[model samples]
Target: MIRNPSWVLRSYPSGMPTVGNWMLEDRPIPEATKGELLAKTLWLSVDPYMRGRISQAKNYATGFGVGDLMSGGGVGEVIKSESPDFKPGDIVVSDYFGWQPFTTIPASSAKLVAATDAPVEASLSFLGMPGLTAYFALLKTGDPKEGETVLISAASGGVGQIAGQIARIKGLDPVAVAGTDAKLEWCKQLGYRECVNHRTSADLVADVAAACPNGVDLFIDNTAGPIHDAAMLNLNTFGRVVVVGTVALADRFDQPDIGLRHLRKTLIARARIEGFLLDDHESEFETAKADLLSWFKQGLFETREDVIEGIEAVPYAFVRMMNGENFGKQLVKL
Candidate 1:
């Protein structure tokens, strides 16, 4: 019998999740049923969205219950199959079952990843949810125009990095704010018009304002605390703000967020602020994948995946990502 190791939620975290909150278990791998196929995980993704899942508070999606298997996006190889649609050795991606070495899922639920000229890992990162989030949010929500100033927070992260690059491709002036000098420099190399080290900048708002002399026309906010406030202050008339991920509020989502109220600024500038989720834009996934892959193939876009070996590192990777220690997309390679 195959020894299948998995990570399960031990308890709901009040704030940032600790390694203690997760428990590892080993169980015999179950066989695929009549309509199900067994998949062995090859790669597991740790993302900011998972932070919200471990909390007790009810989100748009149900929170992980105590002792429940932690689930996220995972790329796996089908080992045993009872369904004709899937054969052994087929690579697939699923969002329903993860944090486990092996999973038995319905054949219809798992998506078969086609053999691409590019790295298959790209199917899980830039050509995956993060890229889709960047595409639809920037195009449909932000509605950026040529020569418009686009400001992206958490600019070196999985989603923000792509958003800024997409903005540049659309002929917009992309300015980014990241925590470290290395991240800022990376963003600059990614073709950002300007990149600011928000952590080192003496005056973050002033820095952002100086970067965008004409003011921010499109703002994709990933960390929505001080960065969001700074973006709000510099928003021009009819500006658009797409609220993607709120890393700044990662630990404090349970409590009331007290900060500079941007209600007056929104009213004055007639700016629009809207929250975005990839699940809401499922229909646009193909379009997004096509554009991202085309750019990637043409050498017009690029991204880095910070991969660590072993499933044992999943919890630590999640925690580190929450602290903004990850320079790119955080992944666990089994």
Candidate 2:
């Protein structure tokens, strides 16, 4: 009998998660049932959003409890199919694949990865949730206009990098706010109009103000903390703010985020701030994927991945990503 090695939540953490919070155990490999497909995971995504899954706070999605299998998005090869929509050897992507080498999922939950020049792992990065998040958040929520200044926080990150490039493609000026000099340099390579190392800036508000002298028209906020304050302080009239991820506040999700209130700045700028979730825009995923692929084929899209090997590294990868240590999309290759 084949055994599946899986990671299960050991205990919830009070602050930053550690490897100690997870346990690896071997279980019998599950067999695909009627209307289900079994797959061998090729790549597993470790995103900032996973922080919420282990927290006691109520998240938009159901939170994982102790003993629950650590779950996230993954790209895999279908090895056993009990559904007509999938067959052995087909590549598929699903959001529910736990931290295991093999998974049995309902056919309805899996999407067949289209054959593209890009690698199969791309289905978990730029061509997957991160790309989709960047796409709709910028175009639909941010409502970017040509020549407008769009400031993106965490600009070298998975979603942030793609968001910056897409803003540039739409003829918008993108100002990147990242943690390290290396990250800022990479943002420059991605064609951001300006880059600011948030870690080195003496006054982030001044830096952001200087970057967008004309005032920011759109703000793609991924790290909501001091960066959020700086962007709000420099927002233009009728500026749009799209709140995607709050990685800066990951450790304090259960605590109140006390900071400078943006009510005055918001009122003065008439800024429109809205939170964005990819799940809310699932109806247009196919459309977004098509557009992203088209841009990629045109050589207008570029992405980076920070990957680790083995399932045991998944927890470490997630912690590294949340710490802003990973360069791009963090993944664990099985």
Number of the top-ranking candidate, with TM-score as the measure: 2
lDDT of 2: 0.91
Best by lDDT: 2
Q: Taking the tens digit of each residue's C-alpha lDDT, what string does model 1 give over 114-219? A: 7776777777789887888888888888888889999998888888889888988889899999999898899999989898888888888899999999999989
Q: Give one digit per residue, the lDDT tens place, for model 2 in 2-115.
A: 768999999998787888899999977888999998899899998888888898888888899999888889989999999999999999999888799998878898999989
Ten-residue region with minimum lDDT total, candidate 1: 115-124
- Model 1: CA > 4 A from native: none
Clashes of 1: 0
